[model samples]
Target: MRYSWLALICIAQLSFAQKKQITLEDIWVKNTFRPKVVPGFNAMSDGKVYTQIDKEGDRQVLRVYDLKTGKQERTVFDNGEHTLEGKQLSLDDYSFSKDEKKILIRNEGQPVYRRSALYRSYVYDMSTGKVLQIDTAKVLHATFSPDGSKVAFVSANNLYYKDLKTGETVAVTTDGVVNKVINGNCDWVYEEEFEFTRAFDWSPDSRYLAFYRFDESQVPQYILPMYTGLYPYNYVYKYPKAGEPNSVVQIKVYDVKDARTVTANVGTETDQYIPRIKWTKDASKLCIFRLNRLQNNLDLLLADATSGNSSVIYNEQNPYYIDIDDNLAFLPDNRSLVLHSERSGYNHLYRWDWKSKRLTALTGGNYDVEQIVGIDEKRNLVFYTAAEKTPVERKLYSVNFEGKNRRTLTPEEGTHGITPIEGFNYFLDRHSTLTMPSVYTLRDNKGKVVRTLEDNAALKGKMWEYDLGNISLRQLEVGDNKTLNAWVITPPNFNDQKKYPVLMFQYSGPGSQEVGDRFPVRDFFWHQMLAEKGYIIVCADGTGTGFRGQEFKKKTYLQLGKYESDDQIAVATYLGTLPYVDKSRIGIWGWSYGGFMSSTCLFKGNDVFKMAIAVAPVSNWRYYDNIYTERYMRTPQENEKGYDENAPEKMADRLKGKFLLVHGTADDNVHFQNAVMLTDALIKANKEFDGEYYPNRHHGITGGNARFHLYKKMTDFVLTNL
Candidate 1:
């Protein structure tokens, strides 16, 4: 019996020796854990077909496939087969016209901002098989007309359109300049905060073009230094900080036939914001969303495209602030609209009748609806995804227009993301859990699986060869009858009696969540490597996070970082009581808003955390932009104490932990001035800390070896300090 037991132990030891250990090179440089995704998957106008971009030889080929059979039907365009000006065409992206008779192909795209880009555009005729370049120079937001007769685009802050037959380009605005007047394109602040790039829309009937004109001559300029060559050059652009002057915006309608422009009446206040301008089914009517400076009130206006006259159709007011999203959709009847609102303390869909001015609920519950999938007008069904199961998981559900017969379409646990086809007959669902990789599948409108797409099978198989740990979700009760959602990742061979150092991660921003059930694509493998080093990783979604309720998300209002830091401290206090945790060796780290949270936690919870690392943090709210900063917190002029009391720079004297501050010098989003201000305060307080700066890097700090080097530096810091 003893000999048999020794043989079994020898076999177990041999099996354990075959398991592989994860390295930083495999996670960052080798691309070992990357998952396969459907590239450029776009649904066709027909509900039965879809188009995807694939590589044939060295060129890209756009091919159409049958949804039901999962077979290739035809090839629409092949860059190797087509030529423009004696050169083979290259395709980055393509969009179909309303009739699908023509396509607008984009190539050689150059990014201008976070959401905006300039591209060399061309038009391809399906009948003639001819390719014509729209312009010799690159253009922005090039769009096709409904009738496929013309194309509109923005160039050098001006709006222009070209007639396909005559090939004549006409300018709609003549006063466009480089840094002053912008036409048919969003300004920097609007593109970043409002989350939109093209600030223009075409009428459904192709009669009028509605666009925005921004006069930013009065706004202040921020200069970013480029450290290259012998002499450094400064790139200057208008940036409106908190309590600074904003651009004067105006909405204009252009008549293509008459070549005239009329400004819409958006009130006399130039400080307000026009977040969105959409065209209704009625070509003569345009819908606009107007928000106040404080963002507490939102008004929906319907404007006449010809006369530029407008009237308020709907209005909503919130005590804290309102969030703008692309959730408003008008029905084909043109008399009703569907949108999401938080009036009931949770985000839910509501249908509003334009003529009758009556509102009715379409979906209601304690859970918040994440997004509106599609509206099946023929079947009178509205499909959406919500947190009905739990705050950390998202499931797909469908309900009638009258808020009856609610059915759960995705019954399995985890997060399910849906993308519906044109006619609402089919959808593409990409689902994943905390432990499982993503699985992409095609489904019918009734939630019947049609076919399996990419399932990340190769990546899943590769993960089994490595020594990974278990990630579990739990609720940590922090005080006041409140509990925070948290996830803990323990070491591979965890023991109940051995003590391990803990590293806490969180973003802790308002309406943000770090403790979700979805697969952690960003830093999952890195956390696993840390776990292999005998450390426990914990992430908690604190009081200011989203999906719980409006009240919970807004609890940090007027005091941005107070409650969030307090909750982290409370969580640390609770984790200290665990038998496996070493209370004296706890550390925290985050990036961007998370970086701000980490800095705040290190200073405010000086007795709890022993070390911290902050990357690209916002040290002061006054250094940020106006639209995002003033939403949660009023202007610094109005709320002086609110902006100063919780600032990390103001609390520099309280730092007792091993601190590491990192930032990219050319980050346009959160300027490097934030780091400079915080460093000044730390130096004046006689505090010793470590710092690193990447020259000419943007907010993401990723290009070539930059990201890998960053992780290496951070890994060494954590190992040495924590």
Candidate 2:
């Protein structure tokens, strides 16, 4: 009997060992059975969140999650209605009513430009459980009024309103025609530069409709092509590159009660840009932010909705150019606005009091305040995340509005985020490091971490199973003895005796730092894969990269990629001293601005870098956007050296490596022309290189197996080409 029992135990142990050797397909299939994380999040007053998530294999859902737990509560809208009655839909976005019952679900969205899209939106009423269609699926920028009774949407390039109760649709603007007078939503230039999508806003009383009426009639038309191939056939937006004339923009307020439209008497000669309009806390006042084509001067105007009178309350100017208030927030009292400014050399927060017309520095330091998430005025506490203490690290802090009592929270280190309590009593802290996944904890207002909700123990164990490298953060002494922060990830199976190839990744844009103290993202996964196959991944935050100070970051003024190449060459110089590094096999790669840097490295630093892969790079500053290029580099004429001195097009003949230029044909951000022109220059200069053209793909070349296939190709190329 003892022998028989022992035999059974041995068989059970063998079975467990067999199960441990699972394949990637098995893991993927098993992961599909679990709940998926949805992208596109919008928080609601009822402590609920809506997102675009997949439900089964083919269908998608605009689901409502509990936020506290990951449990999904209800399916607000589903899209598989062709054959099945109760099927889930893949909603692009969902907007909630004031009461949190009625939801405007956006679907079948077609892109107009970088920041604008026309969609088939539906109105879902929670009480009746009935989904109603608005604008009959031919609308964009559908927004509900403050009362949530009336829905204002853009259709046929015109503003329209729909009454929920009466089911009546009214055309709000008659002069709205394509390429002439655009109402409700913004034009291509305004949308791309100002980042304005829903141009129209409702008054507090929902009686007035305030919007910008863009006159793009004088703007020249730019066109790209569309082709019918394997996937869906389509045409992309006609985008105007840099040095192009932007649209003439102005503001207008429409009175719903009297049916009177008043174009704000800001006067013509407004050849600049009116990017935003918001109804002030006071029902009578409407606020607008306007900037010139150079984007140097910015004005915050308070316009009287009833009288159509306007007054510039505050203005911000810089020698180079001013940046938009990306994380702008209005105080609860409605008397002041919170703004982010780089005027102090570092990005900080300032309070703009409307009544007094005074500016007060709310948060200031050498580090950048990443974003002001929440504020507790009563407690004199302002909760924000910043790169203080260390640029590579992020932490949450609650300081006084007067900028005192700055205490650090989430002392566990790495990238930290906090969700403060309703009354600023308790807070939820989520933190992670390079080797750790996200760990969530409950903390008090005093920064003491209490109950631990999730530690990501499962994910951490899985990551541990896959051998990782020693990811070290250090500072580099680059050109002219400038200290630069950098990170290096040594291959998992690194050996000092063996020479390993290196891949340098970076996005050397102003105020943009790549060397962050965050957990390994998708890039890390690929980096680990390459490291295991004998390659070192290094990221150097060169000059023009933000966070050190204004002087260090703005050194690339009037130029974008020149200083970056010099500093990256310095990185290669440093790496050559290391015994384990193969200096001849060092390569560089990036997307967009990073791509531009990678191209410059291969051409200018041909002796240092042996290979480069630039995906969707801007070959020239003159071919980029106005707001981005004009900010640091200024106009091409004002500073020709900044624009033409070291252009990738001009340095094409200097290429000494096996360069691979990849670009999506439909990428409006960095046009395919960049690739074509670079390719033409290389060919004319008698240089040998390779390229891959993805037709109908956007800036992010993602689709059914497209991303996976492309990455696989990149892996194979890097392994062989380098």
Task: Give me the candidate number with maximum TM-score.
Answer: 1
- Clash counts per candidate, in order, are 0, 6
How well does each candidate superpose onto the true structure, as a TM-score? 0.98, 0.87
Q: For model 1, where is the 10-residue window of minimal lDDT?
A: 513-522
- Candidate 1 vs. truth: CA RMSD? 1.5
Question: Which run of 10 residues does model 2 get worst, by summed lDDT?
Answer: 29-38
Candidate 1: Cα lDDT at 82: 83
Which prediction has the highest lDDT against the true structure?
Answer: 1
**Residue 290 Cα positional deviation in candidate 1, in Å, after optimal superposition:** 0.7
How would you encode candidate 2's per-residue C-alpha lDDT over 1-722 as one tens digit per residue? 99999999999767544432222322233331121122454545643343335565676656665554556778765556421235343466777888777978877788766777788877888788777788656688888988989999988778888999999988889888876788888777667666778889999889999988877776666544555665554444435555666667778888988888887866566567675677766877888877776777888888888888888877888766666755676666767877788789888888888788778887777887888867776786678888888888888887776667778876656888666555565666677776666777667677787666577677666654555677877888866777888778887547789998899888887778788777654366667667767789989898887767667777787778878888988998788778988888899898888889999999998889989989898898888776677777767777787787768998999998989899888776787888999999999999999898787787888656556666766777798987
The residue-level lDDT of candidate 2 at 289 comes to: 79
Per-residue lDDT tens digits for candidate 1, residues 1-722, read 99999999999888777878898899889999999987788888989988888887889888899988879999989888888978877888899988888889998999888998899999998888999899999999999988899999999999999898889998989899978999999999999999998988889888799999999999999999999999999999999999998999999999988888899989888899999998987889999899999999999999998899999989999999999988888877888888999999999999999799889898877889998988888887889999987899998888887788988888889999999889988889999999889899998877888988889999999998898888999999876777899999999989989999999988888898888898863488998889989889999999889999899999899899999999988888889999989999899999999898899999999999999999999999999999999999989999999899999999999999999999999999999999999999999999999999999998999888888999898899999998
Which portions of model 2 miss their true places by more than 4 Å? 1-92, 111-114, 229-238, 266-268, 332-335, 377-380, 417-430, 440-458
